[model samples]
Target: MRQNAERCTAALSAAVSNYVDIFEHVEGQIIHAHQKDQERKRNCVMMPSKKLQTFLSLPKKQMKKSLSETSELEKELGNYTCALHARLSPNEHTAIKNSDYVKLSESIGTSVKQAKKIATTVKLIRNVQKQVKKPEINPSKEFTMAALF
Candidate 1:
């Protein structure tokens, strides 16, 4: 049983390494496709291509919301680090602030950095709104009539 456990661990390690390699290759392909789409005058919306679609379909699991939910369309692009490492105990929700957190520009490009910032800003705004309460006013006589003069 111990031998089998060791073998399973080794296999899992190899599998994870292989997956990282595949993800790296996919990232490169996504970058290339993005550049190509930029160069082309034609929009993907009019005629969707497989490369474009696959690149867009890549799971952005780290985001609190999807690209469509955010105000800025480009904010979805970023380096998607696995949440498995970042996630802590059940009580801990926010990721620990550390240099270990991979920046998108290091793996991807500058575009991703800007996008991530926008996404973060949007999230902050939403959080602030949630915490704040608006003052209620009576519609019948909230404003003074003397102010009109």
Candidate 2:
């Protein structure tokens, strides 16, 4: 009876040990898989694709070109406004005429619709300028206390 009991105890110990060994092996495999996943993620983020670089650069270049074109258009519009203002009679309205837009379209090489839009913008700016008043400035007075310092 003691021998049978010892055999059963030995079998139970062996089974427990086997389970522990299997758990350890599984834990090591999990750690190795986690490390591999981290390494893959790092590589993907660090690598710069050619297509992505081009996609980013193209928009920047286009924005720069568009800005330059807008500046040029502004200068042209300013010149056109000055010329139109010069040709106006003293009692004439400041509003843009169809003829003025046609001439502007011809000068700026834009469509008449675009010229009309620009004319509207100029008129709005003039109206805003008329509404805004300059603040009055008072001359500064010298303080007598400053001489003591």
Kindly report which residue stretches of model 2 are placed more than 4 angstroms away from their true locations once superposed: 1-4, 45-149
Model 2 root mean square deviation, Cα atoms? 27.3
Off by over 4 Å in 1: 42-149
Q: Which residue pairs come into collision in candidate 2?
A: none
User: How high is the lDDT of residue 102 in model 2?
Assistant: 73
lDDT of all the models against the reference? Answer: 0.41, 0.52
TM-score of each: 0.26, 0.29
Tens digit per residue, CA lDDT, model 1, 36-134: 645442321121234323434444432323444553432322212112222222211122122222343232233555535533433443343333224
C-alpha RMSD between model 1 and the true structure: 18.0
Cα distance off (Å), candidate 1, residue 49:
31
